[model samples]
Target: MSKIGNDHLTETRDHLINEIDSLSESQLNWKSNLESWSIAQVCHHLVLVEESTIKAIAWGVKAGEPTQSERKKVEQHILDRTKKIIAPKIVEPDTKLFEMQQIKDLLNDSRIKLHSLLSTVEDKSMLAKKSVKHPALGELRLDQWIEQIYLHEQRHIEQIKEIRSLYEELTEAFSSDHIQ
Candidate 1:
């Protein structure tokens, strides 16, 4: 892995684990801003990326994007999905209201699958070839795609921190047991 990819994966994973560990049930549901995603929603979103990427890697290995026809087919699906929801963040909450385990289970499974692919991905060429069709950035190589995922996680990790801090502040202000 490149320094950037390694750092992002490590840091983002740590932050995500730490943030989730710190959350109370109440805090998980607390909305930081009117337009913001709750912690559960954020978890849901991140898992979707994990799940998608795992599938992508599998496809990349099997089909090995050697043709433009294949790339465009996959690209269209990505484009449609992206157009529907620019980023995973803005997607609506699960109709089940985050009580669903689909996201979590998918995340867990995807993590395993993704790491398996990464471990065996001897083809460094995939990182440089335009394989992923990101809606916002158009087309990107595997390396670039990985970086974007890192950046996306980094962005949300910060959001998680901010939401937790804000939630703490608001609670402290209104908390009845003013120990001070």
Candidate 2:
């Protein structure tokens, strides 16, 4: 396993775990607007994306041909706060709001699968092979895909925080009205 890749996966997983731990069930289900995802939905989406992307990476590796396009260094552009990319319909969150424990279990299971895949790579250089075609980003290697998963989690961290902020605002307003 690439220590760096595993480290990133672990770090992002922990950060997500901590972020959602304090939120109440109502907060988790709250959306800032009709168009936005709730915290629960975002968490669910992360689980879906991580699992599918890992599978795609594994499938690409087994298929075994280096991509024709020269692999450029994969940057963490997904983490950019200023830019927004539309999620492909395949990855859109399920309508049901998942329980917190269920979301955590799914996330952990996906991470374990990811670690297992990384362990099979004997040479770190295979990361540059660009073996898989991502729905949004086109061809990417296993390592880059792994990095993208973490970066995608980071992107949703901001959304989760925004959800929390809006939830807090609503709570405060309701509290003040009751007091009045």
Candidate 1 has an lDDT of 0.61
Clash-forming residue pairs, model 1: none
The residue ranges of model 2 lying beyond 4 angstroms of the native Cα positions read 72-76
Predict model 2's lDDT versus the native. Answer: 0.80
Candidate 1 C-alpha lDDT tens digits along 82-143: 34345644333552345434444655665666667778878656555536565555555566
- Candidate 2: give the clashing pairs: none
Count clashing pairs, candidate 2.
0
How well is each residue in 124-146 modelled by candidate 2, as lDDT tens digits?
A: 57666646778777776666788
Q: In model 2, how large is the Cα lDDT of residue 177?
A: 98
- Per-residue error at 72 for model 1, in Å? 19
TM-score of 1: 0.69
Candidate 2 residue 66 C-alpha distance from true site, Å: 2.2
Residue 8 of model 1 has an lDDT of 69
Where is model 2 poorest over a 10-residue stretch in terms of lDDT?
Answer: 68-77
